[model samples]
Target: MMQEWRRRRQAKRVKPGDGSPLPRFRWWQLLSRSLFTLELVGPDGRPSSYAVDVRQAGDKDDGEVRARLYVDGALRMVSRVPARFPVPGGEIEVVVGGFGMKRCHLVAADGSERQLVPHPRSAEGRRARFDRDHPVASRGVGALSLLAVLVGLCLALPALAETISEIPPVAQAVGTFKSPLNLPGWLLVTVGVAAVVGSIERALRLRSSWIDDLAS
Candidate 1:
C-alpha cells in the first residue's frame, strides 16, 4: 500500500518532454553520465524503444537529479529522481543515489520488475560487461567493495554513538563516550574515500542498502 502511494506520487511528477533528439553518449562523460534502454511490445504487437539518460554532473552541482525518457530516439518525458514514467505495458521507474543510479527498471502492472539494459558506452554497461566477461574477478572486486563498506560502517558506529552520547541529556544518562579508533586525519580520509568508492561500485551494479542510500 505504501509503495503504491509512492509510485502514484512519483507518476504525478512526470512532465512531457520537448521531443528533442536523444543525445549520444560521449566517451568523456563516461564517469558522470548513465544511460539505460528498454524495449517492450505494444498492445498492437509492435515494438517500442525507450531510454533513460541521467546527467550526474548536473545533479551533483545542484541537489536535484533529472531523468529523461526517450521513445524511438525522441524525448518523450522527463522527471526528477524517483520518477515513474508511464510506458506501453507498465511504468519505467527511476531512482538515483549520490554516486550513481540505484534503481532503473520496468515495473509491470502485476508488480514484477526488470532492470533496464545499460547503454554500451555507459559506466554501468562497462561494469556489466566486465562481470559477464570476467566473473571470477568481478566477484572478487565486489567482495572487496562490500568489505570496504562494512569496515567503514564499523568505524562509523562508535563515532556516531560517541556523538549521540555527547548531547547534554544523553550524556547525563550514559556518560560521555569516546570513539575507540581514533586514527590520524589522513588515514581517516583514506578510509572515507574508500567507502565512497565502494558505494559507487555498488551503485553501478544497482545494489543498494540503507547505508548507501542515506550516505549518498
Candidate 2:
C-alpha cells in the first residue's frame, strides 16, 4: 500500500521534457557526476535509450540535489533525488546516499529490476570492470572496506558515549563515563579518513548497510 502511494506521488512529479540534448560527461567531473543508461524496446518495437544523470554538487539554480532523466539524448524529466521516472516498460528509480548514488535501476512491471550500466569512463564503471577482471581482489578490497567501517564504529562509539556523558546536564543526570579505548588524535584522524574512503567505495558499488554506511 505504501509503495503504491509512493509510486503515485512520483508519477505526479513527472512532467514532459524540454527536448534539450543531454550534457556529455567530462573526465574532470567523474567523481562529482554519475550517468547510467538503459536501452529498451517500446511497444511499437522502436528502440529507445534512457539515461539518468546526477550531479552530486546540488543544482546551481536552486541549490537542490536532483536527478535528470534523458530519453534518446534529449532531456525528459527532472526531479529531486530518490526520483522515479516512468518509462515504456518500467520505471527508472534514482536514489542518493551520503557519499554517492545508492540506487539507479529499472524496475519492470513483473517486479524484476536491473541496475543501469554506468558509462565506461565513470568511477562506477571502472570499479565494475575491476570486479569483473579481478574477482578475488575485488572481494578482498570490499572486505577491507567493511572492516574499516566496522573498526571505526567500534572505536568511535565508546568515545562518543564518553563525550556525551561528560556534558553538564547528562553528567548530573546519569553520571560521568570514561571511554576505555582512547587513542591519539592522529590515529583518530587516520581511521576517520579510512572510514570515509570505505564508505565512498561501497557507494560506488551501490552497496549500503545501516551499520556500515551510518558509522562511516
**Best candidate according to lDDT:** 2
Mind giving the per-residue lDDT tens digits that candidate 1 earns over 18-87? 9999988999989989899999898889998999998886666565779999999999998988788998
Model 1 CA deviation exceeding 4 Å by range: 59-63, 172-175, 213-216
Any idea how many clashes model 1 has? 0
Residue-level lDDT of model 2, residues 61-138, one tens digit each, is 987888899989999898887799988888899988888889999999998999999987888988999999999999
- Compare the candidates by TM-score and give the number of the best one: 1
The lDDT for every candidate, in the order shown, is 0.87, 0.87
